[model samples]
Target: MPDDVSTAGRPHIDIASVQRLAELADYVVPFAIRAICTLGVADHLVDGPLPIPDLAKRSNAEPQALLRVLRALAGKGIFTETEPGVFGLTPLAQPLRSDHPVSLREAYPLLVGDLQAWARFDYTLRTGRSSFEYVHGMGYWEYMVEHPEESKRFDGSQAAGTRVEVRTVLSAYDSWAGLNSVVDVGGGNGMFLIGLLSRLRHMRGTLFDQPHVVANAHGLLREAGLTDRCTVVGGSFFDDDVPSGADAYLLKRVLWSWADDRAHLLLSRVREAMREDSRLLIHEPVSFPGDSDEVGKAYDLILLTMGGGCARTEEELHALLGGAGFRISRVIPTPMFPLVEAVPAT
Candidate 1:
């Protein structure tokens, strides 16, 4: 017997049909969140509770429709309605604020914004191809390159995510004490490298990514007063021309964006660029034996649907590294992701 049923004298869900019927509409939450985010609901509620009519006026949405959305969200604990007509932000809704220090509003684009591609998720399962391509008529990176406006949003989302993740990773792992020069592979906008370099003031760094990505990094590096300590390089890792002479190469939240073969190829290229004593640090989510699949599984689905990648288990990653002419040194766990350290095998 299941734990819930065993604890109870009788089964609350004796009929599977009734249970499935009650849970069928669970997919509505993401779209509901996207709808509220699109309307900038959390930002408008900064001061205090507002009546439905007033909130609707600010959002320029239909009063009745906005009221319905407010009511629905309140049930989901995203908002709370006082008395009859006034609605205010719930504790759960605080992270949605655009100005919040640890705001998740930036993540709304990739999470809730890409549901149109996810709507065709079954197509990916059927053909082993990207559903994002099926919907957008191009691969993820190609689409981003062609559309600068959308690409900007996507870049902002990544940098925001890197902020939270870098904090988590730094707290768990030791500082790069012995490593002199570090290169952040596929480093987008130099945000993560900037955070790490700021802490390790003595260490110099390099941010490597595409030309368009590196073009924006110089200004941010200058703004952060890090241009003197960090160099920005523009190129693809696949070409095997990683910026030379760095003792450490870091791939933070990057490897999950490629298929196994491409991941191996990229890692091999990095390996080719490394000296015998150098290290490669891969920071991303991963699975381990007998562990709960909650985080890894959700991320794998997103990769499969949009990014043409997958999160691997420790054993799987071990093989990937070994195949790429490297060996795993250790795996360090963090709140958001793990740090898989590898050294050259040959």
Candidate 2:
């Protein structure tokens, strides 16, 4: 078939190319969803459908504007328009609910928070510096630290995300069930340890992160009935000590936020916390040739824009781990990133 073929005496057309272009340029749907999530629109409609005026008032949004956004999202099957001016929840919109069993309400906004950074992606492409810093006048971590409320929300979103990723990590690694104890370095709010210790009844764990981050871990661990089995410690992974002598030390979804030097320093910190027999388990997406992981690719750019980081390949990981004085014992592949296990070199 020709790239463009005439039909009914009209000019040649390429529907596939047109579709690809439209897909690339489409941003309205995502932005609309982000707006709704940010405004707590879905949470307000939990009781039942609400007229646009009531919904808007509840969400502190303009009635007409909220109606228009809902109408647009309804067409995309996000929310439902039972009748004109009345909006209700749909199956697709359930996760947007803050009270839902699985909530992504916080993640969406945090993902798209720096729209200005994304708009200036060319700056990252040209200079290899963080567009987030360029746009916000500070790096992502500094901004988070300066803004306590936003930092808390970011921690919420990360803990929520860890809930979903925990399944992947657990199912992909059978050795977790066998471990007697594990330490979750940089573990936010102890979600991962909660899930792990809940299943492996005999296992004890420790959750380590910054002071502000681990402050919530105590209550959460208590609520999960894991307080007795898990210890919470507060410190930076770069300059502070991690809990040592656990059967395994976990670095999950954490290192990708930093460039190689910081990442190496973090790994070395964890290295100092490990015994010779202790396993260092790193859970993150690793790049490789012929890889078509769009999520990983998108994250590579997200990391670049936010923090001047990029997804590393297995070889890059090997070098980093080696520099941190560990040897890769095995690399276990998973549906997402492979779990790279290492042990102390000497």
Query: Each model's TM-score, in the order given?
Result: 0.84, 0.83
lDDT of each: 0.83, 0.84
Residue-by-residue lDDT tens digits, candidate 2, 144-168 = 7787877777777676676667777
RMSD of 1: 3.8
Q: For each candidate, how many residue pairs have backbone atoms clashing (under 3 Å)?
A: 0, 0
What is candidate 1's TM-score against the reference? 0.84
Name the lDDT value of residue 86 in candidate 2: 94
Question: Which 10 consecutive positions of candidate 1 have the poorest summed lDDT?
Answer: 106-115
What is the C-alpha lDDT profile of model 1 across 88-154, one tens digit per residue? Answer: 9989998788887667777766443366788888898999888898898888878777878778777
CA lDDT for candidate 2: 0.84
